[model samples]
Target: PVPVLLNYIYSPSTSMFVSLLSVDLPKPTLTVEPESSVFSGESVTLKCEIKGYDGWTYQWYKQDKQSRWSAVSQSEYYTVNRDTLTIRADAVIHGDQYRCSGERHDRLTSSQYSDFVTLTINALPTATLTVEPEGPVFTGGSVTLKCEIQSHSNWRYQWYKGSSRTAVSQSETNTFTIRSAADQDQYWCRGERDDRPSSSQPSNTVTLTVKGEAKAVLSIKPDKHVFRGEAVTLRCDIQWGRDTECKYSWYKEANTLYSSSTTQEFRFSPAEESHSGNYTCSGEDIGNSGYSQSSDAVTLTVTEGPVFSGESVTLKCEIQSHSNWRYQWYKGSRRTAVSQSQTNTFTIRSAADQDQDQYWCRGERDYRPTSSQPSNTVTLTVKGKISNFPLPQMSTYLMFGTPKVLYLIENNAKT
Candidate 1:
């Protein structure tokens, strides 16, 4: 091909020769609407435009953080127009780059690629609210509501009660404390960053139900009237619910007999008069709230029976508020009708060695043969018999008779 010189003359005040050369190609410019910064599940539009150009085909490319680039295709996460790309879904990966370029009908004529624009997807932090001391709580108890964010720090907390959109509490901390919890108090919580106005979705609602205070009851194992030197057990029972791990306390009259005991049964071996008094019990919950209301008072009476030997001892059957009672005594498993009087008293006059045996007493009404519950068994100890010795015969007045009679015989012998 011979190079032919081609020139054109244009007059602009003077005639100048211009050579025919290659034409200049236009470069496309890409701009994203609403900026490249957006939250997840939001839509963004990418537009590629070339000035002074028409009938151009547009192509979009995407690059990830791993330095990999691929041509974008129409899918659930994205859609393509002639010169604009729409991100339809909020599933865009973070730190992704997007760009577009235009091509004309002539393959040789193409526009330079636009500057890369990074797509930053800000993921909303997750929040969860939990209650302390799970399960039903008692009224007037302390409880805490804690909000947790998924691996995020420096987040302010927002607390909501029931379905109300208004926040009950807002603070940099993630916990909400209820010093005295009330019934039917429902709560929810969320988290937000101080720098961002948007907040995470509200957490699941938690409904709090409060229970009434528990009552303690005191029970005695054997009869309330026990004999001295008998084993007795005082049990404290809770009627509200069953909790074996609850702490219990026992009180005798105005004094605290036992405190902070795991066992509900208070044992008294060989019960004495001192153990007989007004007894009450109380219980505490798992949170160690103040002790429950004191139980009804139970009166215990301990009576002494034939405890010594060779002594007059009275065996009384002590009954609670009853008159005109007859007393029946038992000696070594042998029942003996002792008396029928206003007072139930059985006296053992001059108690001998044979009286050393187990004795018990019961109260009976003169009108009926029925007897009350048997009293505790008491063993009586009697002293052994003592022996007597006769006095020895002695010679007397021998010294006085010796002076008068001059001859007197005195005999000292055991007869």
Candidate 2:
């Protein structure tokens, strides 16, 4: 154990045996004060700058993000102030690298090492929350809540609703409109900035369900005066809660008589009057709240009955999906065609009382509804013939044991 000569320093132009012993040294320049482009709750400030020199003693250096080169220790995102280092969390320094050096107030030493500064933590923008015409949202309308932030512009918006820290609305333009919305809601969004991690990271919970504006009722079942061939079913009632789904549209005087349908029936087996008119129905309930307020019309009238002229009447003309039909027969108008048959029955025969009136029929088939909407008007009525009454005097008598029959009537003179 014989060695006593420590703190050794000998560096004469790179002969090397140095702990640190200066004579000519000044290179410190580290700099980075609001300049390294930061964001996660930012607070940067680095400055070393040696230039003319002033009684030094500072020290800090790092390379990190795994390129490894340590010595800037103060932990938890740094704060070593002598020449100033203070980074305090830009989400813990991304891609980290920094430098600084000093040690001269006559401790004889070093200054050089500074150039390395590199940090860019800009990842705190995301705030999503979308629904500007994209949801079932409907309780009186008006819903536009898009706060989608990703970083391309200034950003200043905050809106929250469900867990409520209280913000419901605040905008520079990310959008937030609510007017009359009711029934269900949840929303979220946050993004604001003057600089640094000023806020962001609260989006992803947009519910906004709100539905209760549906009311379509059009129901025609078995009544509304129908009888051409009988069989009509048109139901479109609307509910809106327990699995209430819809997408049907069928109208008739307001136009569009369509029904490729999505359930809720609309049948018509032989229903005439050209399917009668004034009917209404609508209910598109899936999202974005569009069709549902249109249903009280219902005036379908098909009717036809009254036949007694000697009783033979039979005008039928059917085309239930086609088979050869070609029967016309109209008598009131249709330019009065009266008979062009393939025999779908048009018999009148035993009438003779001037045959009565109003009849109708149609069926011509080149296929697709080629002419078949007239039917349902049969009215015929004619009655005459019945007269002859004259019976007065007659007398006959026969008698035998207990049998006697007689009838006599004759009036003359007094009594």
The numbered model that scores best in TM-score is: 1
lDDT of 2 by residue, 22-130 (tens): 3456678778888746776677888887877688877887876678777876778777766787877643567777777888867667877878877777777788888
Lowest summed lDDT across 10 adjacent residues in model 1 is found at 398-407
Clashing pairs in 2: 41-197
What is the alpha-carbon lDDT for the whole of candidate 1? 0.68
Model 1 regions lying over 4 Å from their true place = 1-37, 40-123, 196-198, 222-225, 237-247, 253-263, 286-291, 296-415
The lDDT values for all models are 0.68, 0.67
Residue 86 miss distance in model 1 (angstroms): 14
Q: Which ten residues in a row have the lowest lDDT in candidate 2?
A: 406-415
> Which pairs, if any, clash in model 1?
41-90
